[model samples]
Target: MTVALMWEARAVAGRGGELLAWARARELPRVPLRRETFRAPQDRVLVITWWDAPYDADLPELPEPDPELVTRAVHRWRFEAVDGD
Candidate 1:
């Protein structure tokens, strides 16, 4: 089964672009099947990575960037594929 991981962060005011760039430059220790990035209002950045492992399998994840670049700590979520999707 496939699994997906979501990572998110909120940048400090007026630093959304910098935060996005930082995210784009990251190189995870374990590459994912697919990865995507998104931007939202309020300087938020979200990244989703799809992996071939099972939902409960141990996987390597990217660590948060410098604390000075963000307003709050990063957030993460995990989801398993449903109906073989």
Candidate 2:
């Protein structure tokens, strides 16, 4: 099976650039099948990593940024591919 892990965080006020850079520079302990990063209008940074593992597998995920860098704790979710080509 394949798992997609999503990690999202909102930067503190105008520190969006720094937060985005932090996520880009940080490396995972293990490389995933694919990884992508994104940002939104609310200074929110989102990272999604596709892994070839079970849904409940212990996959590596992006950690929380420095407390001062974000408004709150990072949010994470895991999903299994249901239907796709």
Candidate 3:
């Protein structure tokens, strides 16, 4: 079965640009990954990534950031596919 995964993360105060760049650079080796980012009115940023793969396999791991500089973010999701529609 094919699976879709969604993840959302918020960056610390002024690190959104840096984190987004890191995400972009890190995905260079993967064949099929989709990602998007948006900035809130308060200046917080959100990133979401989607990919197609088998359910049993692990999703691509994001690079860990410096512990002192950023807060560990949040991830949310739903998994679904059309019935061969």
Task: Indicate which candidate wins on lDDT.
Answer: 2
Per-model root-mean-square deviation over C-alphas? 1.0, 0.8, 3.4
TM-score of 1: 0.93
Identify the runs in model 3 with alpha carbons over 4 angstroms from their true place: 33-49, 73-78, 83-85
**Distance from true location, Cα of 77 in model 2, Å:** 0.5
Q: Considering TM-score, where higher is better, how would the candidates rank from best to worst? A: 2, 1, 3
Looking at candidate 2, the ten consecutive residues that score lowest on lDDT are 76-85
20-83 per-residue lDDT for model 3 (tens digits)? 6655555534654556666554324455555676665666645555554357655556465567
Model 2, range 1-85, lDDT digits (tens) per residue? 8889999999999999999999999999999989999999989999999998888999898888989999999999999988871
lDDT of 2: 0.93
In terms of lDDT, model 3 sits at: 0.56
Best by TM-score: 2
Query: For model 2, what is the alpha-carbon lDDT of residue 29?
Result: 98
User: What number of clashing residue pairs does each candidate have, in the order they appear?
Assistant: 0, 0, 0
Tell how far residue 35 is off in model 2, in angstroms. 0.3
- Cα lDDT of all candidates, in order? 0.92, 0.93, 0.56
